[model samples]
Target chain A: MIIAERKPVDEIVEMVSGVKRVLVLGCRGCVSICSAGGEREVEILASLLRLGASKQGRTLETIEATLVRQCDREYIEGIDQWAGQYDAIVSMACGVGVNFIANLRPLDVVYPGVNTSFFGGSADQGIWTEQCAGCGNCVLHLTGGLCPVARCAKSLMNGPCGGSVGGRCEIHKEVPCIWQAIHDRLDRTGRKEDMSRIAPIRDWSAAGHGGPRKQVRDDLTV
Target chain B: MSFTPDIRVFCCHYTSQQAIAEGLAGLKNDGFPPNATIERLLCSGKLQVSTILKAFEDGADGVCVVGCPVNECHNLMGSQRAAHRVLAVRKALNELGVEGERIEMFHLPRGFHPEFVEAVKQLDERTRGMGPSPFNGGTAK
Candidate 1:
């Protein structure tokens, strides 16, 4: 799932400064699950905006709406209900949702309320960790279901880097050495032999390094 | 002329039972600030950051949250959750250039206790010094 966190309220207040009316948009997708941008967050942000505006002796009218999923075209159409009611939009969705609004509604002014962090999963309540780099490659089978590209600080393919100490990354004691965990996981599962094979050089094209990446399914396309 | 701050108090059911039982006159006799309004909640954990912000948006000069003592909450971690939510509102208030102290959280024992009144009095005093909320176009006194 895509992980994100809201930008500071001050920055958002400044973004919509002088705008009399604004739409606070939310997405019920990965961001909602991660608690970054959801219906509840939309309400919080809208209220904060109004409070901030009031503090400045300015009145800001905010319209709150949450789309089922802002990434899809049909859901993006839900925004039409609030068309012309707002002068600008404060999108609480991840970057993709913000882009979808921009791409579909070229005339609308949109501002990102949250910063898109990475493709990750909830580790616990109120906690999320990056799990996939979306490098257009799958090497989990070779690493006992762990991807070095995301978990490993250096994304090392083979063994632990010299920086690993006591099974923790040198970058931070809180970060476990992914290679160490991988080795232990493989050993416990009787698949340690998988580590014996050397991994080949990785290709970077699919990771969006060449440019924006796209996928089209001929069978599903109209 | 003295400033009477409009303080909004949100207290959980268990912790605020006594205050609710006291009736308005009894509370006034017990020194409850007349400017403060008490709202009872089933559980503090059910409180949301938006709710606290709404108080300010609705013209509250200050806000206070009273919940069961941290570990003694009837719903286990309910008060703890409320504390976290209050902290979130405090951060947001600070971000908006308002005094974070305008809102506070209190973990107190349930039933009639002087601490409950004391918490309200403290907030009332603090808010009185702060004058009306910036949202109300008043500066700190």
Candidate 2:
């Protein structure tokens, strides 16, 4: 799922004016999955905007609409009939959904309510950080189920940098050294022997090093 | 078609609404957009998703939760946890077909009067946009 973060309130306030009418669009996909853009966020943001704007005595009309996936045309079409009712659209989806709205309705001004981030998982309830570079390959098996390519500060394939200390990355104490974690996990799993195997040099080419790559199955699309 | 949202704001005893006599002393601020009501919990982290949804069932237009500045939380990690809960609630909002924006959790210092004032005003505006919550008059029915 696409990951995203909420935009600053000040920035969002500036995006709308003569803004009596608004449609807060929520996405039930990646942005929602990551908690960046979701139905509740849409309401919270709408409330903030409404409260702030009304304090100035300027009235704005606001409504709520959530789609399954704003990035997909089919789901986006759910809003087709209501498009004429709103003065502007505040999309609580990832950047992709926001842009998709723009593509569908060129005349309407669509504001992105969140900042899209990279593919990642929720580390816990509220915290989420980057986890994948989308290198178009999976190498978790090479390391003990750890993706050093995504976790390591250097994305080092061979071993830990000298800066790694006490099982933590020297760059930032908050970050546990990814390489150290790998070693610990390997030892715990009794697979320390895998580390001795001369890991071949990574074929960077497979990671789109040659260029942008696309996978197409003619059967999937008519 | 219109839902008057109820809002619950979680404040830190140190810096949030509790610090200002206005939040408690001024609890009488014209009530909230029909269904809107403000309740002070021990800490923003005290907020549970179930508790928040209960407010919705009782008829709330939106819910606002304010916490201590990240590390400044009196309870150490309470504010952080609250923030995370807010994120989870946002996801819940998306799934439920209701605008998640209705629920907000923010952080404030001990004397964030300016921000506090701003947040209240924002909450008011958002409720207005929602017009009138459908539960406005029917909750008792």
Error of 2 at B67 (Å): 13
Off by over 4 Å in 1: none
Residue A91 in model 1: lDDT:
96
Worst ten in a row by lDDT for model 1 chain A: A195-204
Specify the highest-TM-score model's number: 1
Q: How well is each residue in A1-222 modelled by candidate 2, as lDDT tens digits? A: 567888775567668766778898999888877766777667666765664354344666778778888878888778877867888898998878888889887788889888887778888876787777777777778688887887888888877889998988887899988889888898899999977766677777767889868779999977
> What is candidate 1's lDDT per residue for B1-141, written digit by digit as tens?
688889999999988887888987888898999989999999989888888988898889999999998999999999999999999998988888888899999999998888888899999999888888988998634
Judge candidate 2 at residue A70 and give its lDDT. 89
Candidate 1 lDDT, A1-222, residue by residue in tens: 999999999999999997999999999898899898999999999999998888778999999889889899999888889988999999999999999999999899999999999999888899899999999878999999998999998989987989999999998889999999999999999997887889999888898899998999999999
**Clashing residue pairs in candidate 1, if any?**
none
Candidate 1 CA-lDDT value: 0.91
The docking category that best describes candidate 1 is: high
Best by DockQ: 1
TM-score against truth, every candidate: 0.97, 0.61
